[model samples]
Target: MNLAENTLANADFMIEEIKKKLRMATGSALKATKLNDEQYEDLKDIYEMVAGKTQFSISEIEAITTELGRLRKA
Candidate 1:
């Protein structure tokens, strides 16, 4: 009920909201992309690389996206 407690609670609520929005957006993006099974793991790896400390350039992103386009379902 104190100031710090209230601030932490608000931050937690905001983070949960952010997580929900992120999931929704990501799901929509995946559906739109229509990624194949082979691309699923590649996309997850790319997501982790982007989320983590790895800094990717616009060219790298373009290359990854292009690679995903090349994947076809068996």
Candidate 2:
């Protein structure tokens, strides 16, 4: 759970945590394996932002989901 490392496992951890914290309705669509490793830093940024807060506006969730979508592997 040492997310400071940029490993695939860390990416998976961050993705799962983000999904849980966001209570994403389409969580299944955002699996860690589907994400691009090159975008790990971006994902980490999102994860940190999400983790620091307990609440989110509808628009904020949508925006984060969208950003995650953009980071998905093609």
Candidate 3:
């Protein structure tokens, strides 16, 4: 997937990757459809940050998840 393009497929890819990297227990709740075009860049930024790291502290995971929550569509 060419994530450089801001498409929904790319967004879905990033969201799934982020969930795996973070080992999010509630990942199912964070669906790609919940992400909108307005939040794509923010999600991309989060995805990049998560991708660059191999491990995360509980606090870091919480913070990242919280940020994602803020970006989710209501």
Candidate 4:
């Protein structure tokens, strides 16, 4: 595979990982309180953001992961 294809594949994998994490988090939160309309809206927003349907690119997963690392470090 070429560089662009490899990069896209990595991004897709990262997106899937993020979706999995989000699902876990949302599930835990739901166990606490049934997802209200606002909560569902927030989850949808998060899904769009991570899935790159908004102003983000699929490749942005790397940047996001990096930023998360930095936040954890701090």
User: Per-candidate TM vs. native?
Assistant: 0.37, 0.82, 0.86, 0.32
TM-score of 4: 0.32
Error of 4 at 64 (Å): 9.4
Models ranked on lDDT? 3, 2, 1, 4
Show where candidate 3 strays beyond 4 Å: none
Question: CA RMSD for every model?
Answer: 12.1, 1.8, 1.5, 13.5
lDDT string, candidate 4, 1-74, tens digits: 23123243433344354547544332221221233344334434444466554445555655655543333333
Rank order (by TM-score, best first): 3, 2, 1, 4
lDDT values for all models: 0.42, 0.81, 0.84, 0.41
**How good is model 2 by TM-score?**
0.82
- On residues 1-74, what C-alpha lDDT tens digit does candidate 2 reach at each position? 68777887888788888988988666666666665656877888999999999899999988998888778634
Clashing pairs in 1: none
Residue 72 miss distance in model 2 (angstroms):
1.0
Query: Candidate 2, overall lDDT?
Result: 0.81
Worst 10 residues of 1 by lDDT: 24-33
Best by lDDT, which number?
3
RMSD of 4: 13.5
lDDT of 2 at 39: 81
